[model samples]
Target: MLDKKRIDCFTCRHFYITWDRDFRKGCRAMGFKCNEMPSIVVYQNSGVECLRYEPKLPRKQK
Candidate 1:
């Protein structure tokens, strides 16, 4: 048996495609593409260096 899980769109930083309206607009405004999925992976207990640990942006308050 295998355990599988569906990826979450919100959790993914690169889930948005280039053709997506949001990504298109954002890219134009920022002059770059936004990451579409969660690129960082923190270890459960390992105290090792991680190259993919990108800090998440603060959530906007509305």
Candidate 2:
């Protein structure tokens, strides 16, 4: 069983903000938008943690 509690969609590479009234959040890897975090939506419908989650790389300092 996957522990979905520690999953933070904000730190994921695929996470995005849509600016939509209804669906404000989105995932590029899974290709879906939602009012809440995309990971929650995926887990709720699929009954499993998001498998496509990839941590965003840190930006290099100038």
Candidate 3:
């Protein structure tokens, strides 16, 4: 069994979830577009290569 918490990269001390613009940057760096959902880490205490994490954007509604 696994325990998962609801949080983002900026909040957690580990993991990194890429945002829209940064997602693009990551894609460019990886030489591929971020088409497979812009998530960098989905695990706790995972090692990260991201040091430029920013807060997650507020949700938008139609």
Candidate 2 residue 33 Cα shift, in angstroms, is: 0.5
lDDT of 1 by residue, 1-62 (tens): 11234233344332334665654322221234444432211122233332333334678999
RMSD of each: 9.6, 2.2, 8.6
Could you give candidate 2's per-residue lDDT for residues 24-44 as a string of tens digits?
A: 999999988999888888888
| Stretches of model 1 off by over 4 angstroms after superposition | 1-48
The TM-score of predicted model 3 comes to: 0.21
Sorting all predicted structures by TM-score, with the top scorer first, yields 2, 1, 3
Please give the clash total of every predicted structure, in order.
8, 0, 0
- Superposed by TM-score, candidate 1 places the C-alpha of residue 46 at a distance from the truth, in angstroms, of 10
Q: Rank by lDDT, descending?
A: 2, 3, 1
Runs with alpha carbons beyond 4 Å of true place in candidate 3:
1-32, 41-46, 56-62
By the lDDT metric, which is better: model 2 or model 3? 2
Q: Which ten-residue region of model 2 has the weakest summed lDDT? A: 1-10
Q: Write the per-residue lDDT of candidate 3 for residues 1-62, one digit (tens) a residue.
A: 12443333344232334565634323222333342322343222244333443455666897
Error of 2 at 2 (Å): 8.7
